[model samples]
Target: MTSAPGTYDAAAEAIAARLASGGAAARIAAASSLFARGDAIPHERRAVMDLACAYLRLHPGRDADGEPAFDADDESVRREILHQIRERFLASSGDRWDHQQIPLTLARTYLPDVDLSKVHIRSDRFLSGAWVAGDVELSHATIECGDAEHLATLDDDRPHFQLTGEEGDLHFEAERAAGSVSLFDQLRCHSIDGVGVTVRGGRVRVSGHIGAVRLPVLTATQGVSISGLVGCSFVGLLGSDLKGEVSIDLEPALSAVDISWSAVHGDVSIFGMALDHGAARVAIHLERLTVKALHLGGARVSTCDLAELEADQVTVRECDIDELRLDGALVDGGTIEYSRIGRLSVDDATLGPSWVRDDPPARVDWLGDESRETVIGLNIVGSTTEVPPQGLIDNDCVGTMGDLLLDGFPVPLRRDSGTARSGAK
Candidate 1:
């Protein structure tokens, strides 16, 4: 098959010759052949070769026994390749492969079964139709690449798909300043790990089931859209300068969504946010969330909608200069403490005893309350209460015709409360 220098046949012959040499030089030649024939070789052939090479390199003169023939030092590169396979295609173990590397200026090619576990890629590694094995670990690995439109489509044909490192470990620090990294299908990981999975100044579209994603500091600048179920816990989103809306469709009914410190300039709507502790920007919308502690520090919520929520406690510290809407909520034991609000509306919501800040005099009238009954509005302790003329209240004077409670005290339920209290009309 030896032909011209630039011919495909010539390149295949060169690869076969190198594999036959059986030495470091030969191994390097073989590696070069695999890289060159990334797209040329079929998936089945590549998989089989990868497995054989790893066994030979790692097992090292031992035939399925604890016997050693070749020295580990003599076969280090081969061992490294096996590690790369594990990290690149298989699961990541604590033992990392740190010396391997991938060139950046390489042509846009196809890299099947490409392993980069614990490997520090000095250049931007871009490949199309890349088939990755599950349980791959890229903890503390950095990948910086070229501009937008450069795509890397991972395999989505298999089930139980995931990209994760060891427990409490990161997978990859892929930085495509302008390019894109599309992770399709199901991606699973361990909790309290995956510190930073950033997609900065680019577009990252992931259509799959993401579980146990932990990024203490997560930033999606420029354009980053994450669709599908994001079952992540203990996260912090900062500076999400999305030109469009950021939508998240999570599991219904109290799905835990805890953001330590997150700020989104664009609108954020989560299907359910069981917030343990976090800060957010703009607006926070939850479907069935259980918020333990929440702080919207100087964030703007045009409408804070809560649906099927079962929050034991929710505290909106600081202040939010926006409209607050709470609907169909079932809070067991918590408080909705607001420092100051532009407009607040609570409709068909159940609140466990709460304390409103004594900052502004606002209006609140809705259903389901465990506080004092009032005609127009209930007067919270240390806060002023406003009573509209036609507001409902429960009183002892009339059976079902009493005023709403003000400050846990029974008040008359009358349409003309101001006039009645003033003894007019």
Candidate 2:
């Protein structure tokens, strides 16, 4: 053993030959002299993590699109060695790592509310990352990320997130994962997919139990609520620009709602949306609303509120609206294409080739029928741009059919018994 002196321990081979080389500022000064060395000697930080995993197995930037750019100066030397490992070995209570199973190889640190259900996130197959600064609570917790199918991709340099999970059975198998995930209002989760994670902003309250949530680029500044979803699918929102206040509560009459394309501003409520599971029929848009039946098949909506508005198989496509309201209404069946409804309201209504307005609305207010339950199916084939004065034509008004012609009528009728209804109490 005396011969071991010359066996190349030349000060641990000069810090493993300056962490194996001269590129990227000598690997950020040998990763700040081997993780700032304050691991306080556990076989000298496991011989500097076995010479940093043997120079990451002879480095091709350690594979997976050539890693090694946790940038911003390696997140300012990994939050100053995690504030010197939380002031030299984090232990103020039951194991913050004093129980010593700390593995933050490709480093980034912040562990605030610190209830990762007895944290054992050991992802060191070759360096991923970690962060949990404030409000992290998984009450029946589990974070089991030792080799989470080789998880990576979260070096956005965002070290500020408030996380919460409650009432037992909380788990995340993390891949490109997490921060800005909330499930309050009666939060009940036993399963929420794994390893395909991306969270931007969420609040699924109203007796919330979010089962299926998928996000590609969902960013919210405030207000996101969700509740009561059963075997539901809103089909992959194509051109997505949905912002704050996204309220979804679907589980009524056997739950059916599938939103498409997406360009909402705030306040979106969906309760008991119908017909889904790939028989493929879903369209939704309303302002003043009540529903026992609504079938908007090629859906695009700004607001829909029809109190007794049971328009069966309702459909509208290419919708670009500023306003369209029909109260105390009931018109059945659906189809309308290339829509532009700025202000079209028909109160106490009845009108109906399944009531498809082949692009109607510069402004029309029929103000007929308030309440006695008899306004049957409407088919208004008119208005190139706001016209309704041919006796304000009734039998549900008619003037043109095919390229839809009707020039001027109905500008003086504002009897909105004002049934002010959108949805979600």
The true-versus-predicted C-alpha distance at residue 139 of model 1, in Å, is 4.9
Tens digits of per-residue lDDT for model 2, 1-425: 11121122345455445444445565556555664552434435433443443333231212266533343443433344334333333233342332223433322222222233322333322121222222223222222233232222332321211112222221211123223232233322322222212122233232323343433233233434555544334312222344555555444322223333344455454433222222332333343332223433222244443333443444444333334455444555454443334445654444433445354343222312211111222244221222232323223312221111123123332124321222221
Error of 2 at 285 (Å): 9.2
Where is model 1 more than 4 Å wrong at Cα? 1-145, 148-181, 184-193, 230-245, 252-254, 272-425
Q: Highest lDDT: give the candidate number.
A: 1
Off by over 4 Å in 2: 1-186, 189-240, 243-376, 384-386, 389-425
Model 2 residue 216 distance off true place after TM-score fit, in angstroms: 17
Question: What's the lDDT for all of these models?
Answer: 0.35, 0.34
Clashes of each: 23, 33
lDDT of 1: 0.35
